[model samples]
Target: MQPYCKLKSSTRSLSKLVACSALLLLLDLSRCFSHHTYEWQDSHTNERLVCKQCPPGTFVSQHCTRDSPTICKQCPKLHYTEYWNYLESCLYCNVFCNFLEEEAQPCNSTQNRACQCKPGYHAELDFCIEHSSCPPGSGVAQLGNPQQDTKCSQCPQGTFSSVSSMDPCRNHQNCSAQHLEVNVPGNRFHDTFCTACKISKGSEASDGLEDGSGSEDCQDAVIDFVPYEIRVPRRLRRLKRIVSRSSQSSKRDRKSLEELQMELHTYLVQLKNTEKKELLLMFITAGIVSQSEVAPFQISAGKESLQVRRK
Candidate 1:
């Protein structure tokens, strides 16, 4: 019984000693954190004392001793110390701005270099990506900045975005205001295409301007952007005077020219009487061909339908 009692007392003392040691260790850690200490021990007396940390933009010139505090000196140019530290040297400004990046913040004693993506580009992860353009049927909802990507939205009804760009959608054209017929209706991707109806006597569409200038052009119809070479023959050579140039012209010049002529002849055959009159007038005005040069064809002018013969 005596031996058991002694063993129990020894166990209790050991447990108490362990608890005290743990409490002391926790208190030491809390004190170090609250005061931000760098504790140093004297080798001879085993005495420990806290050393002061250098502030930002500075470094420790010398460590603390028994009688003196930590010696500090301001960091040199191009060196940085962001926080209170006992570091022997400051860090270098290693970040550099590339072509796709711009300097947002220059390197200083307390901070390092900072970079951002250039205009028309947005940062993603570690790289800069060019802003994406909206498609034909869509438009830009929100433009992008250095930190984000471009946002796009579908074009709404009665509006159209004909081209892929960062611009917003535009309203469709009003055909009635132009005194024309809606040949093709507008949607999200394309504007309304208009065409001219035949001008009859006492018709509403024929009420032209007082200057009498509305009959010639089909009432300002949307004519395609035809190239000069495609619309008129070039006066380069004998072949050029007949038809425009093509890729196969070099290999089979005469045959291709004849084929192009046949195609033009077919188109002319398909044109309406009013269109034929307009074509003849255009040719006469532009000096491309003469009235006598044209073959036999029928045309209509205002109230009269006239037939022309080669003369």
Candidate 2:
């Protein structure tokens, strides 16, 4: 019983020794973990640190001692710091939008610039709108929406538009019957009338004007007026007055010559007619004389015939 008690005591002591050694090893590991540190630098490179690195998305603007971590500041207003142990200063924010006044927000070291539309100008699409009305004689055909202006056009000459718009033309010619031959088709300002062309004696026209005054070419009418030459009888030609260039012949001499020729021609025609009349008279006289002579012979023949018949 005494030997069994000594073996149990030795075994118990060995277990206690093993437990104490494990406890010492754990304490040593804790001290090593506590002593673990990282060197850090400030943005100006003027300060130093003896601790772990700063967190991501944050930058150390100033160094810290063993008792304190580095002073980490957020990036300037709208900007952000995305680096670790940043040796440079924090960046500023960029403009959120642009402006036409040239007073837009400026971009920063860490952000890009932006743009936007102005007031009274809707940016529904990519265009601007002016809800202004059309001028006096003009009107709008298509009324623009919030993004576009209302388009207006002019009222044409013949058209009388009460309102200005982009509408099509309307007012037309007011031609009526009674003087209405054919409506010369056009706008209201042009020739729309109740007039007609002239109709003259021995001439005609499609418009209301005299011959040679109308559309007919005067040159063309002259061409039709006179022929190149004319012809007359030889007897009439002899009666025409002739100008004499001879020294002995006066102007009156040529006139006398023409008169003489006309008289000669007239006498020749009269003589020919007289001869024809005398021959007709001679034939008649011969016919009467022959008839008388023949009648006496017939009577004597008849008497002879009667005596023979009596015998």
Candidate 3:
């Protein structure tokens, strides 16, 4: 009877253990099912509904009901969502290429337009501005890019620029006029200045006496007018005549003609300088030169010269 009692007690303990294991397995299965069911619940609605998320490039047109799936529509023109969303309407694309800006990329259902600065303009902060040019006496320190403006710096000593551009400053010209000495050293902002020699007349005379030359002979003659002013127009006229006569000149002569053209250009620069100085002097003396008279003076370069015409 004791052995039978012991076997019956072991059987009861095994049955209780089996019942507990079954209950734990059922509890796990129920929890998993509940999680799966609630995963797609709509949070905005009072009555929670199982709703699938709208895909990218689309927006929800209608909410999911108990028996229906979420209704979605493709984003309209110039509209985009980019990512999956539960939004009721598509987002409007706000990017636009204005007058100074250009379209880098066109708008699509999934993305907004991309913009950049147009040619001759550069982006600064949030907007576009006209590209800057290095003015005369300055040079481009840094080139302009799509996103940045051109940077300019003052030309260093012994160099200069005469026009507004992106070019580097050029070296100052040496004094070439006879019997003249440099009065002022050139800087980045101004040209090298030249003037007559400042040695005393008595010193020059003494030097001449030592060399057995007269005082008058020792002194260099001061020019009344710039040689370039008198010579350039005549040279230009001569070149034009040559060009007219050279219609039959061979291609081999073209090289010589180009050399002449370069020479002419140098002369023209000198003439321009002379004229500029003269005009400045006239302004200082007379305050103003009549525009009509100035026009005629420019046209009749050889026949009419600038004179103090009292009227």
By lDDT, who's the top model here?
1
Better of 1 and 3 by TM-score: 1
Per-residue alpha-carbon lDDT of candidate 1 for residues 1-311, written as tens digits (9 for 90 to 100): 22212334545787776776777788778867777558777566678878888889999898788888889999899899999888989999899999999999999999999999999999999899999999777899999999998999999999888667989889899988998655446778667765553322231122222122334344222121011113233322223233322334343344333233334433443553445444444443445544333211122236322112212
lDDT of 3 by residue, 87-194 (tens): 888888898888888888889888889999987788888888888989767998888877899899989877987567877788886876555654335656445545
RMSD of each: 12.3, 41.5, 20.4
Candidate 1: count the clashes.
Answer: 0
Best by TM-score: 1
Local lDDT at 214 for model 3: 25
Model 2 CA lDDT for position 21: 69
Instruction: State the weakest 10-residue window (summed lDDT) of model 2.
Output: 302-311
Report lDDT (Cα) of residue 17, candidate 3.
67
By lDDT, the better pick of 1 and 2 is 1
**Rank order (by TM-score, best first):** 1, 3, 2
Overall lDDT per candidate, in order of appearance: 0.60, 0.37, 0.53
lDDT accuracy of residue 96 in candidate 3? 85
Per-residue lDDT tens digits for candidate 2, residues 109-150, read 334444444443434455444355664345566665544566
Supply the TM-score for candidate 1: 0.56
Error (Å) of candidate 3 at residue 164 is 2.8
Candidate 2 ranges with C-alpha deviation above 4 Å: 1-58, 64-67, 75-79, 82-88, 94-97, 100-311
